[model samples]
Target: MLIGEVARHSGVSTRMLRHYDSLGLVRPTGRTVGGYRQYTTEDIRRIFHVESLRSLGLSLRQVGRALQDPAFTPSALVGDLIRQTEERLRREQELLDRLRAVEHSAPTGWQDVLRIVELLHGLNSSSAARRQQTVLTSAEEMPVSTDMLAAAVLSESDPNVAGALRWALARAGGDGIARVAAGLSSANGDIRQRAVLALAEISGDEANAVLAEALENPDAAVRRHAALAVGGRGDTAAVPVLVGMVVEGANDVDAAEVLGSLAVDATLATPIMHALAGELTAHPADPAVRIRLAQALAEMPGTIALAELRRLATDPDPAVSLIAAALAGVLEERAED
Candidate 1:
């Protein structure tokens, strides 16, 4: 076959075939009387081989080595190609994700598109400062999509960046609550924790509802955080968990404070007093537990807490009695105020 016929048959363009011949990648096997290049069956087969290698991302030089060198091993080259392809795929997937985020933002024009893209890039940046700046700067410019904030918060590992992202999410409004809530169900423990923390900062009924669910989570840390958040909102349901935290001495001080706040409601005051009294009764032998409970009891307002503190004041353990007596005196003075 002549060059044109070979090009037609192989789908390789004539110019490329000539270029291949010039590079000695594929030379014509013969020439006609007019001295035009001619290709034999062997030459056409080589062209197909070159095209085959090129399809696998082989450069022309590599293709020449692959076709001509009997010593060339494809295993290394094939492995390299696989790595390169995987890298390309990762880049492409990231691009697709950015595009989806931009689409989710419902950008009104090129400016919105660019802003969203920049924010997405910054969120994925290696620098925690850049990520934090992205969220703060973009927030000042326009409303960030909740999905973007949700994703950033879930993946954020740096303490400062995570805090800023939470603040940004809170400022971005409740739009991302569902997305953050979805993270609560993630199999990753860190992700679930992040979800609960983010939810704690979000001010909405939906966020509160999700935090309510988290209060029963099997993860003790998750449950504790959820309880604290719910208790802050004055939900009585958190009383038991807050009470438990006092007994276990885990953030017991803060838990007691929240319980005290809950006790401000007249209706909650009695139950709050009862719950602490019950803990004291259940763990009478545990003086350390009693000491924490004694402090917690003092956080409550009204005469019930004062009476409980007085009863604890005469306890047999000197340390427990000492702390209880001190708290009772403080409450007695406060009652006068």
Candidate 2:
């Protein structure tokens, strides 16, 4: 077959076939009387082989080496191609995300688009200060989409930058609650904690609902954080976890305070008291646990907590007795007033 016929059959363009010939990648096997290039069946087969390698993302040089070098093993080259393809995909995905963020911002002009782009770049910067400044300035100067803020909140490792992102997300209202909520299911424990922290900062039914869901998270820290946030919101659902926190001495003071606040509701007072008393009973041998529980009781309203405090005042452990006695004295003095 002549070069044109070879090109037609193989789907390799004539110019490309000539280029391949010049590079010795697939030289014509013969020539006609007019001196035009002519291809044998084997030459056409090589053209198809080159096209096949190109489809796998092989550069022309790599393709040539692959076909010509008898010792060239494909394993390393294939692995390198896989990594390169993955990197390209990652870049494309990032570009798509940026475009979506910009589109969601609803830019009125090129300036708005540029500003949004710059803000996004800053948010993704390696410098925590730049990320924090971007969030702070964007809130006042331009409207950032809740999606971007929520994403930043979830990924931010720097405490300062994370706080700014959370503040901006909270100010953005409940719009980003679902995105932040999705982070709760991440297999990463840190991400789940971050998700709960962000949810705590956001107010509204949506955030509260997500917080309630987070209360059951498998992670103990996530559960504790969610409990504190939801308890402060006056949700009695956090009672069990709050009680647990006091027993475990994990932020026991805050847990106790939230419980006391919940106890303000007349209906919750008795159960809250009983839950504390139950923990005390369950851990009788553990004086440290008992002492933390005794301290938590002081936050409860009504005579029940005072009665519990009075009983603990005579406890076996001197340290427990001393702390409980001090708390009991304070409660009695309050009763007198």
TM for every model, in the order presented, reads 0.74, 0.89
- Candidate 2 stretches greater than 4 Å from native: 1-9, 28-45
List the global CA lDDT of all models: 0.91, 0.92
Error of model 1, residue 184, in angstroms: 0.9
TM-score of 2: 0.89
Please give the distance, in angstroms, between residue 285's alpha carbon in candidate 2 and its true position after superposition. Answer: 3.0
Top-scoring candidate (TM-score): 2
Clashing pairs in 1: none
Off by over 4 Å in 1: 1-92
Model 2, backbone clash pairs (residues 3+ apart or across chains), number: 0
Weakest 10 consecutive residues, lDDT, candidate 2?
301-310
The worst-scoring run of ten residues by lDDT in candidate 1 lies at 298-307
Model 2 deviation from native, Cα RMSD in Å: 2.6
